[model samples]
Target: MRRSVLVAVMAIVSTVAAGCSSDPTDPAPTTSAASASPSGKPTDISFLVYGAPAEVKAYRSMVKQYDVDHPGVKVHLVEVSSADAALRRLRKGEVPDVFLMSRRDLGEIVDAGINQPIDELLDSRGVDFTDLYKRDSIRAFSHSDRLECMPYGISPMVMYYNTNLVDFSEMAEAGLDVPKNHATWTFDQFAEAARFGARRGAKGVYVDPSLSGLAPFVYSGGGSLFDDDRDPKRLDLASDGSLEALTTSLELLRKGAITPTPRELRSTSALDLFKAGKLAMMAGFRTLTPELRRTPGLSFDVMPMPALPDDRTLGDASGLCISAKAVNTSAAADFVVHAIGKDAVSDVAAAGYMVPANTEVAESDAFLQQDRMPAHAYVFNRSVKDIVTLPLIESWPALERAVHGDVYQLFYSRVIDIEALTKKIDEESKAVLSPPKASVTPSPSASASGKN
Candidate 1:
């Protein structure tokens, strides 16, 4: 009887093993389609993006095309008004399969454990990082020696001048030194241009009262924003090089006769003033091009940021990132590859706000838009070489907030103490740069005896 029971158990085990074995004739499963549900339902993934109306429209169109191209997958497009709003959503624990992120926010995003490294995935997807995209842009999204996101847009700040207000040809004829190349100019030449444009009841120029607005000048003057670029401990704005740069920039930026008066600024924004033909020059990025073109009577042109003995400028870089908790990472990565592809990037470039990281499309007419207002559109492309991206640090946003008032005072106040102001900026920055460690709480037993 015992032998008979053993035989029956052995037979049942063999049967179960055979049932679990795969059929030799069955097709292999594909990684790209692995996201499909067990019930054979199509995979669904979400893509979060934020931009202007036209830019949002372009992203929607891309999603629509991607959905059509891949019948087995559906992409849900989520539009936010701005990058800050998107970051808020992420902080609230709303994780999209894929999202657009500013490179500046990479440090914080990584610290939050929300983004996944995609270097191997991108390689598996056949993305040609070296040949297809800008090296600097790619580096902007890398952390811990791994690619955290795929770079999309790289826009360097440039000076946008009203053609009707500041006529370069006329300035040249009047014996004022004008930039012969139009893409390069010295600090003195920039000051002269500003003085010349201060006419027809218009302000000469307006540089934003913020760190980003002043960083390029600091860098070009052989100054550093931080004590150390890679692992910064404090702001170095009071250093000799930085002070010299600030002094030169302030000469033109602080002139009440040239820049918009405080009362005027409170009423009308510098951009609107420029549109109304009441402001001659302003510092802006590529995204401003499309809006300027659409302005009824606004004729504008662009130039590289004025150099302080060096060609340097700040750039805003953004990229596509995959969520660490994505339900379908394979599908999400596929969408990222699609989004940065030549055709997809081209469509957005045509909208005029994106300075595509895709080298091929950046050189195409889609971005240049020869018929547009900024006849010197090439300046945007050329300025890429001069772009100096800020270090990736989690405390950057808070640091900027801490120094905002001081920076504003430095730019706007008529009588100020430069040394004291810069020194204060450094001290305030230290609090964010190296926040104090949290104190340990005493246990009940230890507290009773006042000892551990």
Candidate 2:
């Protein structure tokens, strides 16, 4: 359901965008002016990245290569585990020349007003936007016609099923064939499969209590989390289609189809449960592919998450942003371009840790080839067009927490009342979206005058 943004969980930067061109054909990269120092003067620029030790090491290695190409520039590598932490560093006046982060963090970053628009910088460097590998990736990171960041990954949610546990036998018995492909599965058919598998003693599904997990369900039911995406004051979770979707999902838990109720799985992860062979199916992003590959004796494969007729899959992206306050803006811009360049993308794709934002790397045989279980590695890329972008708003984090918190409370309590729960969530969300009261207890002079 929800992919952990944490470095260790998926070994990917949190967030993703819609999929791009089906054609993986490599194209010539945009020519950018070299980071040649006219004076041949040495410069030190800071680069901030998130993830585990391995990711940090890999970035350092990549930077070393960049240094060789641009001898006058030196990159000081800084590591942090999450976006909030990076923002904290920025608040403390430790702004990096460039920093890699999730697109979801853009709202907060914009609020902090520390990032510079990349258009002027890109133009100055002669990097044609069209020449970039993934056009959709770039579009996903842009807001209000402003190119705020350069994308690095296009992570989309997909379904992972334990081949050994899913009810293939029951499918045959019921004269119901298992979906031949990701696109073939429907919500009704999916439910039938889950019900059949549950009867055969398999736990049907489990999802995290996060926006990523809930968004698909809402969209499938012809509802959205926001009433009006452009208006930060509008959150529309408690409604018709979303209500129906929420009801159906909760009923599965009540019927013992989905295991480890939200409360029960407080500490245990859905991924761990699936890897241990206890789950029949669960939803996750592409990074799950690598983790599932490394686990022993797990016969797992991925498919697109089953959806209703109107549903669109959720996709988010993350990339690099230059600090508006960066002292070495030119060098920072050059470093970001180099980091997501074609060669870097090839290495990233080969590692199988993430789907590269570069179209060439993502579509290339190296990324498409599967020595791993999910023979349908292309599902992530193929599902790009169907992606539903979460609204960009400063209050998104608050709204997400509000929605998830109330939903889980209802799920664990076995309330099974969709209308009531939705109403409650709607009420709470309204409070978040509403402007704060002015808190006027009369001016101090007025108060004194009135008292007298």
Could you say which candidate leads in lDDT? 1
**C-alpha RMSD of each candidate structure in angstroms:** 12.4, 6.6
Query: What is the per-residue lDDT of model 1 for residues 299-318, given as tens digits with 9 covering 90 to 100?
Result: 89999999898989989888
Every candidate's lDDT: 0.82, 0.67
Worst 10 residues of 2 by lDDT: 1-10
In model 1, what lDDT does residue 41 have?
A: 83
List where candidate 2 sits over 4 angstroms from the true fold. Answer: 1-41, 124-128, 131-136, 167-174, 199-201, 262-268, 440-452
Best by TM-score: 1
lDDT of 2 by residue, 1-452 (tens): 11112112111111221122222232222442244456666677899987545456678788888788777788888989866677678768787889887777776676677788775555444444554444556666665456677778887787778877775665777697577656647777777666654535557777666666778877876878767655545556677777777676656645545566554466667777778886778888776777788899988766676777664688757778999989777678777767776776666566665677776678877677766668778887876656676656655667677677776765566544667767777777766666467786788888888884
For candidate 2, give the lDDT: 0.67
- What is the Cα-based lDDT of residue 70 in candidate 1? 79
Query: Candidate 2, TM-score vs. the true structure?
Result: 0.84
